[model samples]
Each structure stands twice: as C-alpha cells, then as structure tokens.
Target: EAGVAQSPRYKIIEKRQSVAFWCNPISGHATLYWYQQILGQGPKLLIQFQNNGVVDDSQLPKDRFSAERLKGVDSTLKIQPAKLEDSAVYLCASSLRQGQGFYEQYFGPGTRLTVT
Candidate 1:
C-alpha cells in the first residue's frame, strides 16, 4: 500500500502572508485528516473528511485556516494571514474508517511551516 504523500516538506513565510500545503492519502482509505503539530505538542486535528463530506472541523481556525478534500482522495490546507504561532508541521493522515475501531492513522512526513 502506498503511504501518505505531502509536499514542499518545508516552507518559510512572513507573518500575515498566506501558505498552502497539499496531501495525497493512501489508496483504498475512506477517511482523511489534517493536523497541526506545534513544537513540543502532539498533532491537533484541524479537520476530518469522509468521502468528500466533512465529518469534523470544529478545531479548525475559521478566520485564518481552511482545508478541503474535494475528491475524497487528495486534500489541501491553507493558512492565510499567517501568524508567528502558526509555525509547525502540517500533517496529513488516512484510515480505513471511523467505525472500523481502527484509529491507527498513517501520517505523511508533513510540511513544516515557519513564519518569520
């Protein structure tokens, strides 16, 4: 099975600018997720999608961050007017399904964003 794929791998941007990251999940997976992992903290879920429909996005910062999984396959995350504290690793993950009782999420290497 193919693992998750993410791009750029690294980014540096000034505060108040915008940045975006992309992800492609493993084949045959039914659930996808995006997470923000700050230094010294575990990944925090930004959004979750199940076959193109949003399952959860309560933790996402509406004013500055947005994401979408259009085809239930590839996904993108965007942060506009970036803040200094937004510097972190944006991780993408996928799983079989929520009901499978298998919460083991396979993660991508992640895109590390730095705001200077």
Candidate 2:
C-alpha cells in the first residue's frame, strides 16, 4: 500500500501571509488528522476528522488556522495571516478507524513552511 500524499513539500512566505496545504490520505481510511511539528518538538495535533466531520480541534489556533475534510478522503488546511510561530512542518495522517482501539496512522512527508 502506498503512503499518504502532501503537496508543495516546501514553502517560504512572509509573516502575515496566507497559505494553504493539501493532503490525500490512504484509501479506506476513515479518519484523518493534521499536525504541526515545530523544531525540536513532537508533532502537535491540530485537528482530526472522522468521515468529514470534526472529531477534535482543541489545539487548533482557530483564529488563524482552519481545516476541512469535505469527503473523508482528502482535506485542506489553511492559515490566514500566518505568524512566525507557525513556521513548522505540517503533517497529514490517516487511520482505518478512531476512538475504539489502537490504530496505526500513516503519515505523509509533510510540508515545511518557513515564515520569514
């Protein structure tokens, strides 16, 4: 099986600029997630979606970041007026299920965003 896919593996933008990232999860997966990995730290969950509905987003900076999984297969995350703190690797992951048992999440290579 192939892994999840993400676009624009690298991006450099000025602070306060807006950016969007695209992701396509593995086939048959019912849950998808977005994460932000800052330098020298573990990835932090930004949001999770189960079949196009949000499952959790408490960690997401709602005022600047937004994400959606319209059809449960693909998703997009957007940041408006991005901040310097937003400079990090944006990751996308997916699993066959969520909330019941342990499920392995397949992750993408991630999009590295640099806020200048």
Candidate 3:
C-alpha cells in the first residue's frame, strides 16, 4: 500500500555546489522515473528505469546529472556543480506496470532544491 518516497524534503545549495537525492519505489513496481519541475512549468522527465535497466535518459543533463536504479528497487539522482537553473523540484515516480497499455504512475513527495 506504500508509495514512492524521496529524502531531504527540501534542499538549498549555492551555484556549482553538488547535491544528491534518494528515492524508494513501491514494492512490486517494475518501472521508475525521475522528473524535474520548474516553478511555473510542468514536470519534465529526466530519466526512466525498467527493472534496474535504464530505459530513457535523453533529457537528463549528462554533464552534471546522473541517476541509477539498483536492483530495481531503490534509485538515486545526483547533480555535480549544479547550476542556478537547476533549481526545481525533483520528483520520483513509479508504476506497477508499464508498456503500451495505460497504467497509473504514483509520485513521491518531491525534493525541493533551491540554488543561489
């Protein structure tokens, strides 16, 4: 009955500082995702993992951002030398099933990061 969970409910960092985030998806879920949401914009998918394997990450800022889902249960996202533009809410989500069919993706209480 549990859902996704993210750590450090909020974070504040200076420009060029590094930061890390953690997420735990619902049990039995097979797909996980990470997204970035700006103050006034819709969440943008950053990366996706399907059972310990990466499915998509073309939108991720490779130069400074990285994410991994180990053992297909827990996931972590990190940013190094973060830019001010990186200020946003980092959201973690998971779905019980994923594919061509429609399924619900549950989201966690996002990690709000502020860059100064």
Deviation (Å) of 31 in candidate 1: 0.5
Cα displacement (Å) at residue 5, model 2: 0.1
What is candidate 2's lDDT per residue for 1-116, written digit by digit as tens?
A: 88899998999999999999999999999999999999999999999999999999999999999999887799999999999999999999999998955898999999999999
Question: What would the per-residue lDDT of candidate 3 be over residues 1-116, giving only the tens digit for each residue?
Answer: 98788998999999999999999999999999999999999999999999999988999999999998878899999999899999999999999766834878899999999999
> Candidate 3: what lDDT?
0.94
lDDT of each: 0.93, 0.95, 0.94
- Please give each candidate's TM-score: 0.96, 0.98, 0.96
Per-residue alpha-carbon lDDT of model 1 for 29-89, expressed as tens digits? 8899999999999999999989788999999999999998888889999999999999999
By descending TM-score, how would the candidates be arranged? 2, 3, 1
lDDT of 3 at 34: 98
Better of 2 and 3 by lDDT: 2
Instruction: Name the regions of candidate 2 deviating beyond 4 angstroms.
Output: none
Q: How many pairs of residues in model 1 come into backbone collision? A: 0
Model 3 steric clash pairs: none
Model 3 CA deviation exceeding 4 Å by range: none
